[model samples]
Target: MENKQLLEIAEQAKENAYVPYSNFHVGAALITKSGKVYTGCNIECASYGGTNCAERTAIFKAVSEGDKDIEAIAIASDNSSKNEITAPCGICRQVIAEFALDIKIILGYSKGDIKEFKIKDLLPHSFTGNDLI
Candidate 1:
């Protein structure tokens, strides 16, 4: 799907975020190489560390659907006042790196700001499943 469409999906996903802890709602959308799109929102847990990020949730959902080869991802957050729109975290990056290194990542903000980059751009020289070989 087009980045614009993916951004729309991410925005919709954000509405489903269950973030009572930090109150930072985030959403993610992943498009598979075969043209299927999957979306997810951040789910926060009282345990803090048990929280799951929108990026990982979307990626996991895509993988579970047998979309092992991801093409692109978009992340959106309405909490732009406190933080700028950015890519996935180290853990999410590594998880994405496992399935896709050349995947495109679209970071979106509430104020109409947007950023785009390949997954490799966020995690340069990252250790992936290839590292196990």
Candidate 2:
């Protein structure tokens, strides 16, 4: 899928974010190598630690469906700013690295500004399943 299309899906997913505390809505879209797309929104919790990021939500959903070979992922936040780009957190980065070390990560804004980065670029020398082997 095109980056813009993937970003659009992520933006749509952002609307479903359950953020009653921080009010920061984030969305993510993961695209498998086979062209399957999984979209997720940030889900917050009262306990804070129970919160799930948008990226991980999408990745976990894909994994639950037995799709691990992710080709690309797009993330967008509904912060009402088009110039502000948000990257995945440390935990989300690690989770993404587990399945796709070289996956493309697309960070997008509401005004059409987008940036792409490889997973390795976000997490260099990451510890993956290879470390356990």
What's the TM-score of each model vs. the native? 0.91, 0.95
Model 1 off-target regions past 4 Å?
80-83, 109-111
Q: For candidate 2, what is the TM-score?
A: 0.95
Write candidate 2's Cα lDDT for 1-133 as tens digits: 8888898899999999999999999999989999999999999999999999999999999999999999999998965255567899999999999987889999867466788999999999999998999
Q: Write the per-residue lDDT of candidate 1 for residues 1-133, one digit (tens) a residue.
A: 6677788789889899999978878889998888889999999999989999999999889878777889989898875434477568888888888887898998875346667899888999989767788
Clashing pairs in 1: none
Each model's backbone clash number:
0, 0
RMSD (CA, Å), each prediction: 2.0, 1.2
lDDT of each: 0.84, 0.91
